[model samples]
Target: MRPTVHDIAAAAGVSLATVDRVLNQRPGVRRITREKVETAIREIGYVRDVAAANLAKGRTYPLVFILPASDNSFMHGLHAEIREAMIRSPSERTSIRTVEVAAFDPAALVTALEKLADERPAGIALVATDAPEVVAAVDRLVADGIPVVTLVSDLTGSRRHHYAGVDNIAAGRTAARLLGRFLGDAKGEVAVLAGSMLVRDHRERLEGFAALMAQEFPKLSILPVLEGRDDPELAHMLVADVLSKHERVIGVYSLGAGNRGLVRALKARASSRPLTVVAHELTVHTRAALIDGTIDAILNQNAGHEVRSAIRVLKAKADGLAVIDAQERIRLDIFLKDNLP
Candidate 1:
């Protein structure tokens, strides 16, 4: 049988109220008394029943998730996942709300974070742009005791408690391996399209791709990175420009969202030259492109898994409970035309 508060109080020679105060970090307990209670708790291995505690406190963690307002299909998918989570939230004893802001706008994101912080929700989940002001805002929220988790993209130097996303470096390595092996000893220039260098995920993906190309596929040369800002129209224009300039380009890797533009660009240029394309995210456009031989492979991160992981971690942190590491792990999902889910 597990020991109760009464047993801990008796063992520490303290009143029940004193033990309660100490355990909950409430006021009115002396340091010595608190230490004695803690010692007793340690000796007895007393673990607080989080469910019971929350129930007693009538706590239902209100979580706020801030997502990018980009028209990219991937962001749309993430929004859908969050909506699904909201539908299932009641069963999990929590409530969730979302705020959408323009992508790649650090000032706008910071302003949104500030507003959310003012509301003082139990937790916050956001896709962070690698900006100093954004990081400072997240730090301020952490300092105020709000649990913040970075989703999709991370703020590495910030006080965000956890990042609920894939190791984009590994994802890039996987993409390179797939592209290199599929192309087999074929050598030609490879064009790289990225969302923006300001995003940590995009930067990491570029780094991994560069490392793999330099070490393993020295035969293939990487062209200057094209910034699409995860915009379909921008991606299309950039891809068209690259294709026009480099007729010898054999492959393309899009390490960002907005593959619709990529597909359009590839289809337009397919008649003149067949370029093997590898992109991130398995959206409808990319999936159809893969089926029609426009795209060779896709490196995807499950948005549903990311959203669920963030919610779980935020809830645990808000309740001061340790998170289950394995359960919170985000995995890279590989997709080929043959198998896509």
Candidate 2:
């Protein structure tokens, strides 16, 4: 196989971004670093022909990011990362526009997707809501020759060009293992909190978590999943009610945002024994919960990395270039109190 930019970066002992800057002849690289990249390119026999590639795709791309309009900390962080990407857009020769719709509202998401389809942006990166209408809209975009990538959450049966997120099933199984081990021989019940079942990621997570729990930890009972819609107040109320109703509940696997509410409910509960909580995403609330012994483990997908990966994938698809799958894969991060960053 021909050496790609990744090979050049590895050979030069530099970052992928730096390699891009050097290859694109963008500013801000030190003379030594530029020389090292060039030397690596020559040694690896990596023929970039960036001028030809640029000439092939002469138009600047206008990409759109459709994120959920939620007050959740994770959503805020995702938006912050997208803003950072916007800041770096000039160097990438792309302009970004962001649209926000209500979280867990499938109709709203479908409407937003339809609106973007009419505009026909070069590429679209979306945090998808699993709905038939949304999927149809994605099909329309794909048919129109527009690159569509799902960010964070995925939509099945859609012609999306790529999914720039973690393997959520693995994430769920990992969460279940952490919670099960944390519980040890103790047997009770595990309550699950999710954002919405409409999202493929959340559904896949619950499936993996339940399957593992049934397979490995047979003694532990899993309660029906409660949807919090990624809302803190709703999550707090649902969690509080579940805790109140089930005295034997010993663990919680939160597969979505609304951790602020989960933490609040746990704190307000009048129980002598604490529940083993394994939750998704590392946010301010989840981190504090982990530190204070309210949450056991945090399964995290780095928002910045996901956003950056989506942008990279979309740009590559827009330019009719192949993306390095290994380089674009987003990692699932597991954080404990000791390993918090």
Candidate 3:
């Protein structure tokens, strides 16, 4: 049989009450008695299950998820995952709260972090707006001994404990390769559309895409990136205008959200120019677009998996425990028209 507190008392020549006092570090137990119980536990290889102990003691970690108040499909999906985690929070011993700030506003994000620091929750996770002030705020929280994790978009050069997102640079390079190979030497100007350059993921994706395109596909020229602010209307306006003017633009790459606008613009293009389009995130619109042969390929990351990872890492950090790196690594997913999931 597995050794229990009774075994420790029997081996240490102590009463059951004395064993409990020693194991729980109660004040009544003497140092010598504690040492004897400890020795007995070591000899018997007693292992305490932390989850069960926390449950028995009614210990809960209060966690906060700071998100952007955007109308993006991916953000909605992320919110859904957090809600799912909250549903399981009773059994998981977690109390989760969500805070939304204006998207792409660094000052708002810093203000939120400072307020959260004052509240002093056990852990905080955010969709970081990559900026100097935001990094400073994150570092301040870390210095205050708070476990901070960056979710989705990350803050560059921040002291955040973990990032629960995919390798955006690799995702971007992959998008470039897919678009380039799809074009197959029929090179022309490739127009780029983006939500914003304020987030690390979008910037990293653009960096990778441009670098690989310049190094390998020199024949295909890249146009200036159109900032759509991830708004469907804005994206549609920009893409539709670009399509009307640039007759030679044969390929398009959307490295951020606002794909709904992109799809609408592509469908409404005045010219029947064949454009090989590549985008990110697997959503209802993106799925339909891919199936209908509008977007050539999509690179995606599981938002639900990222949210779960952030919570796991946060709990581990709060308890001063090490997390398995393999379990925490967020992987990239590639999808094509032939394979949609």
Q: What digit string (tens of lDDT, one per residue) describes model 2 on residues 1-341?
A: 98998999999999999998998789999999999999999999998765356755565779999999998999999989988988887777778989999887889988888888788888999999998888998998899999999999999799999999999899899998999899999989999999999899999999899999999999899999999999999999999999999999999999999999999999887365678889989887888888988888999998999988888888788777888999889999999999987
What is the descending TM-score order?
Answer: 1, 3, 2
Instruction: By lDDT, rank the candidates, best first.
Output: 1, 3, 2
What TM-score does prediction 2 earn? 0.84
Which of the predicted structures, 1 or 2, would earn the higher TM-score when compared with the native? 1
Candidate 1 per-residue lDDT over residues 37-99, each given as its tens digit: 999999998889986888788778899999888989999999999999999977777799899
TM-score of 3: 0.90
Pairs that clash in candidate 3: none
- What is the alpha-carbon lDDT for the whole of candidate 3? 0.90
| Best candidate (score: TM-score) | 1
CA lDDT of each prediction against the hidden true structure: 0.91, 0.90, 0.90
Model 3 lDDT-worst window of ten:
47-56
Provide TM-scores for the models: 0.91, 0.84, 0.90
Q: Which stretches of candidate 1 lie over 4 Å from their true place?
A: 9-43
RMSD of each: 2.6, 9.7, 2.4
